[model samples]
Target chain A: MGDARRALALVRKDLLTERRSKAAFNAMAFFAAMVLFIFSFALGPDAPGMAAGSGQTLLQYLWPGLLWVAIFFTGILALSRSFQVEMESGGMEALRLYPGDKKAIYAGKLAANLIILGAMELILIPVSAILYNIDLIDKLPALLGVVALGSLGFAAVGTFYAALTANLRARDVMLPVLLFPVLVPVIVAAVKATTLVVRGDLMGELWTWIRILGLIDLVLLTVCTLTFEFAIEE
Target chain B: MNHRAQAAGSDTGRRVVVEAREVSKRYARNWALKAVDLRVEGGELVSLLGPNGSGKSTLLRVLTGVTRPTYGSVELFGAPPKTSNGKRQHLGVLPPQSYLYGELTALENLNFAAVMYGLKSHDDELVEALAHVGLEQAADRQVRTFSSGMRKRLALARATLHDPELVLLDEPYGALDVEGIGWVDAFVGELREAGKTLVIATHEIGRALALCDRAVSLRGGRVVYDGPTSSYEGAVSGATDSVRMEAKR
Candidate 1:
């Protein structure tokens, strides 16, 4: 119970800190939007499928890619910025000295990253819906489930890599190097699961992918939680 | 001739909170601590003094259960240091580096640490700890903006916030200014007055001499002198003078 409270306090600290600065969220959201805009222009207004295809089918195909791309790139942006606030402010070591369970620290960071990525996804979802002409109202719950599962996998790996690279001399370059390799399986599973849902396939393929994602999240989270103490220790 | 022997001979009569028997640690090709032994009782402030690379930090790490000794054993609060939750719970550690988050404000850092120690209603405690370390006004400020003195004070606040029975500080006063050092001295004095045992590893001979009840001087990972702080200093000075005279030859 005390551990839970401490974890919540750590989460609250990250939220409050981000609320004050707005730098992390802004950078992530802008980067995500830029990616979407580039994709939109590259696939131009008069491109192969834009004129002849049924808007629903077009959206169903494009929505999954758009959502996952936004999330993946934006996640990288946000996770890279995970310890920036702490490092810039010179407070990373101070947090470690606290007598709380190191797990709480990991959870707190995961929570903050989830919140930032979730917010970015929320914005990207609507923008992608309109731009790609996808009708998502009927499949809201399923889409949400996919997003939640995928985000968990991202946050689980992201938090660990952030701590691992926090002290390295080339943290900016090191984070993606370490994170992308480990996250490849997660991204593949998430993309496949999201595509099935976005197409409204209803072929029951979603559950298998969801289960795989769930297992991946669970394994990564457990490993990261146990190993985080060593990564953060001085 | 060894402090370990004297401590063992003395342990039968009194309560020993921490006891290290023939503890040694080796990292790869280098031996960080070679057959070191120490015993610290409750309510005693033992200053561990040594030159750089004398294994002071390594010894503290072993004692705190953070590092396993390659040879020998350590018991804390009458139980093997690793097995006893009560022993581990009673210990407070302040490492040489600031173990804190600079992104969070001073109050947030203290609050987070206090909660981890399972303290209920730490608002007043946090405020009091900050005030004790002269960081009350800057409590809402991020630690990154703090000067070295303020950062050290914040570190001290975090270490003592839990009110643990045993406090292990590694160079706790290294970065403090004169005034900041006085503040730390007073804080340690207060903790001592309240019967909390402290083991501080530092090179500041004067501060250790003035603040500690007992001092142990380490040379090549061995305790060469362990006794009352006053006698320990004279012995160190005499040894230094001898080495200097020998150099003339």
Candidate 2:
């Protein structure tokens, strides 16, 4: 079979299983909403007095930080569960036995995590804007673009680590510990880019941050694709 | 490394399908398999019998390319097994535990394997496989709801759903009942009749001796006995009687 076809089949299998079980979706979606709500409370009802005539409140300043924090935690939850299914059922060995470029398996898993996280972000973005009381309609496209790139970075590394840690008894705790350090570049670039895009500065620092995200994603995707065969093998 | 033709219903003109030369798998300080040499002819039901931790599973893993032998060469279909997906596609493997997802239905589990094997249409094969395993009525039921015996049946169905030429099963009768064991014997018979090769790693020496064309016994990662199943007692001497009785029980 062609690599692309096998990748598609794997993705289809994952999505169909997720749809039927709703295990990851239910837990991830609920956790994402709770994170947003908690941030809303933590940010406080009264807008803190930051800068007069600066046209931004403390909540606005914290938007990028809080949003990425939410995504980081939620992404870990979703990615961990993605491979947990395979590990718990011993399906990883079976998947490794599939005939094709093994990279296709990694590609399929990365795409599935991206889709699940992306769908959650779609819901979280609007609700987050409402809770944070920020008007993001104008910058929505740019913000989403940055988010997509940053998410690709997250999925790339997260998918690799998820497979690495799947067999560990401490996988749930180990995943964040191993993943967060590596995700520093993505989180930094995403926060900086999202802040600028949300602040209506699309042509200056935003592009630089976007470029950084793209570069990180490119590097991580290549590295993960090259190493996933080893990660899943015995 | 000669090639073998494995078309169904043709077992004559025996040819080699699996070849292992001085295959040794070492882990840390322990050797799992030490200088083991084995060759399986096409269309043979070869049972690997051994006690706990006797390297049956390790050898099976080596043959299936799930693990690389530490110090020797192994091949399936006349080539090193590790690098070729095409050869793996023509092979089917079942470990002791079921690998099927509990959330997926019986049909869905088979469908996943069919898709992985790049089967264009499995509707008919799916039905036949399910029926062959006597899981037709439970085809739409989630695997989690099935009993252990049922799950084993479903796993067998899923493994063979792709019509693989060689089947490698490790402890295939682990969770089976009396009827399930009978079913497995019948299934192996059918496979032998169809000219498909099989390697079954099992602890049940009596059943394996009764069903397999040949038997290979391992002790402490080394082959202790390899010959016709009928003369296994003579090959291993007095120790075989106790192990065989224990296995029968």
User: Which consecutive 10 residues in model 2 chain A have the weakest lDDT in total?
Assistant: A45-54
Q: Best-fitting candidate, measured by TM-score?
A: 2
lDDT of 2 by residue, A93-171 (tens): 8897777788988998999999999988998888889877889888888989999999999999999999999878999
lDDT at position B179, candidate 1: 88
Which clashing pairs does model 2 show?
none
> Residue by residue across B87-136, what tens digits does model 1's lDDT show?
45577888887767766788988887776667774577788889888889
TM-score of each: 0.84, 0.92
Tens-digit lDDT string for candidate 2 (B13-86): 68878888888999889888977878888888889988898899999989888889998898898888876668
Q: For candidate 1, give the docking quality class from DockQ.
A: acceptable
Which regions of candidate 1 fall more than 4 Å away from where they truly are?
Answer: A21-23, A50-63, A80-102, A131-133, A164-175, A202-204, A222-234, B1-9, B26-29, B68-72, B79-86, B237-249
What lDDT, from 0 to 1, does candidate 1 have? 0.79
